[model samples]
Every structure is written in C-alpha cells, then in structure tokens.
Target chain A: GAGVSQSPSNKVTEKGKDVELRCDPISGHTALYWYRQRLGQGLEFLIYFQGNSAPDKSGLPSDRFSAERTGESVSTLTIQRTQQEDSAVYLCASSFFRGVQETQYFGPGTRLLVL
Target chain B: DQQVKQNSPSLSVQEGRISILNCDYTNSMFDYFLWYKKYPAEGPTFLISISSIKDKNEDGRFTVFLNKSAKHLSLHIVPSQPGDSAVYFCAASARVFGNEKLTFGTGTRLTIIP
Candidate 1:
C-alpha cells in the first residue's frame, strides 16, 4: 500500500511571503495531523482534522497558521507572512482511528526555508 | 513547556553492536509512547510502540522498554545494521475523544559505523 505523501519536498520563501504545504494521506484514514519541526527542536503540534473538520486548532502558533482537510485524504498547512522562525520541516501524519494509541503513518514532509 | 525530551542529540555505534536511545517525558497524563525512525529527507516510519499497561515491547531486533515510575523509556537495537542509521524520535500522547495530540522529543541521530 502506498504510504502518506507530501508535495514540494522543499520550499524556499522570502520573509513576509505566504507558503502552503500539502499532504496526501492514505485511503480510509479518518484522522489527519500537522506538526512543525524547527532545527534542533522537537515536533510541535499545529492542527488536526477528523473527517474534514479540525477540532483542535490550539496548537497553531499564531493566527497566521491554518490548515484544512478534505474528508480524510489531503490536507494543507498554510503559513502566512513567513518568518525565520517558521523555517523548518512541516510534517503530516494520519491514523486509521483516533485514539491514544492509534498507529500513525507520516509523510516525507516539506522543508521550508525562509530567506 | 517542552514535555518530551531526548537529551542526546546524536549517537554512533558499530555495525552489529547495540544502539540505545533514551527518552524522557514530563507529562503524567500521557500513556502511549511511540518510536519512529527517519532517514534523511524522508518521513518518519513507525518502528515500535508501547502502551502504559506494558513495560516492554520487542519487534525483531528492536526493543522498547518503558519505566512508568520514572516517566522514561528507551529503545534498544541489537546487531544494528547500516540501514538503521537515522534520526530516532520519541513521541507521547493521551487520547481525548477521538483526537490525540502528540508531543515529540528533539530526536537522536544514530550513525552506524560499518
């Protein structure tokens, strides 16, 4: 089976520009998640969607960050007015069922660099 | 606050030797833990996971040991192969309703010297 996939494996944007990262989850996955990984730092939760609706947007660092998922497949993480702090790998993951121990499959990630 | 922590930034081991990676968490509510392996420019692949009910879980040459009292867990790879060289991340989460939010560690880069 094909695993989760992400597009634009790498992106370089100037400060103040907006960038959108895309994620394609596996078929039948009902839950989708977005996370950010800064250099020398851990993964930070961004937003999560279940069946096309996001229930937890608390992790969004600021109002400039947003994400949307269509049904259970593709998702997009948009960062508005990019800053140097946003230069990092944006990861996407999906799980079959939403639970405390559901196994998650991850995408290759989009590495964004703000210049 | 950073809940999950991986103190060591990198580790090196000889081929066929054992590689140990440590992870610690401060969140007492988290009961599920997972370990992921990532290659350069690739997404993290699920390696193994342990629930709060169990103290240890093993898969092939990879073993994950958890100590609830200490809120610590470690992954051990025996007879490590060159293919196992990659960044290892430890993540934990507690489920609420159907959505579970995960907190990850800084990750440890493992290099196997063949």
Candidate 2:
C-alpha cells in the first residue's frame, strides 16, 4: 500500500456485540502500532508488532482487546463484548524501524461507535 | 499519569499571523519529539520533529522548538493559513530498550481565521 490503510472507516455496533477493526500497514515497514483516541483525548498506545510477534502488549486495556498481525503486514484488532467506552477512533501506524529515531506513517483510522 | 501535556485545548489565530502551540513533558529520557497535524476523520500527519541534540527543526511554514531544560517544546506556524487549521498533537519517545512507544498529548485545536 502507498500508506497505512484501515477498513470500516465508520462503524456502529450495539453494546455487548463484538467488532473487528483491520489495519494494513505500509509495505516494507518493519514496525506496526495500534492506538485508541477518545473524543477530546490524546492517542493512547494499545499494542505494537515488530514482525509477526508483539513484544509490548502492556497498553491493551483488558483481555477483551486483543490484536494479531501477519508477518509485518496486515493487523487486526478485536474487541469482545464492547461497551460504550469502546467508542472512539482507532489509529494504526508503521515505521521503517522499531527504534525511536524513525518517523511513523499513519493510516486514516477507523471510527468505532459502540452504542 | 499524563507524561505529556498540552495545556491549551484550543487556539485561534488570524491569517498571516504567527501561531504558537505549547507542549510539556516530565520524562527526561525522551530524546526525540514530534508534532503531528490531524484533520477531521483523518489520521495525524507528521509536521516537524526535533532531536535531543538540536534545539530547533524547521520545515517551511512549520517549526518545532525544544527546550530540554524545561522539559518543554513548542510548534510555530508562520504566516498561518486556513489550511493550517487542524488538531495538533505532541509526541515523545525515549531511546531505551523496548521503549519505542510514543506518548502523546491531548492535542490542541488550531483555528485560523481569514
């Protein structure tokens, strides 16, 4: 892809329902990240994938939020038994390096509304 | 705790004037800082960045200044234009083992008046 891409730009789900959000990171980028942003709040780090594995899952709010990646490419974020608090924009980013000096390229983001 | 903070939630500036937005962080290990601009329903776009070694980095109309002593940073937009109206976020990262995660501020909404 030319840049990071996210599917289901806008989603509306009923409470207690499960929802899946997808992200396709930039090609050749070795690092992928997921973040959540609530209205008027900052982007909160969720998880990170280096290649096919995630070394930092400390940011996952709970066990209900789990993410998986396929060999440095596409990633999926799944939320089970969604609550109203899950309503927010989920953003994905990728970078050439998994180090601090690298600049990240972001995807358009998926806006999820859990009613 | 909110390590990075953007005190001002919103800012208004007249076209052609200079607009300044501020950010502060408490962590001393943060060696790099970045500013991202975001439009409605869109992801943030990198605007400018400054490394720990340099005090300032400029890219055309956008400039980022870092004050390590005060743990403070700022973004300046010269000759502000309507197109510059967007939410700006400040992010920081440290050069440590498995600490590549970026911590971001709440973001400041900049409104440019024509």
* lDDT by residue (tens digit), candidate 2, B51-109: 99999999999899999999999999999999999999999988774756789999999
Model 1 Cα lDDT, one tens digit per residue, A2-103: 888998899999999999999999889898889888888878888888889998998899999988987567898999999999999999998887344688
Candidate 2 per-residue lDDT, tens place, A4-104, comes to 99998999999999999999998898889999999889999999889889999989999999999997799999999999999999999998774548898
What DockQ class does candidate 2 belong to? Answer: high
For candidate 1, what is the DockQ-based docking class? high
DockQ of each: 0.83, 0.82
Candidate 1: residue B48 lDDT (0-100): 98
User: Considering every candidate listed, which one attains the maximal DockQ?
Assistant: 1
State fnat for each of the candidate structures. 0.86, 0.79
The residue ranges of model 1 lying beyond 4 angstroms of the native Cα positions read A98-100
lDDT of every predicted structure (CA atoms): 0.90, 0.93
- In the order shown, what is each candidate's alpha-carbon RMSD? 1.4, 1.1
* lDDT tens readout by residue for model 1, B2-100: 799999999999999999999999989888999999888888899999999999999999999999999999999998999999999999988643477
Residue A88, candidate 1: C-alpha displacement in angstroms: 0.9
Flag clash pairs in model 2: none
Top candidate on lDDT is 2
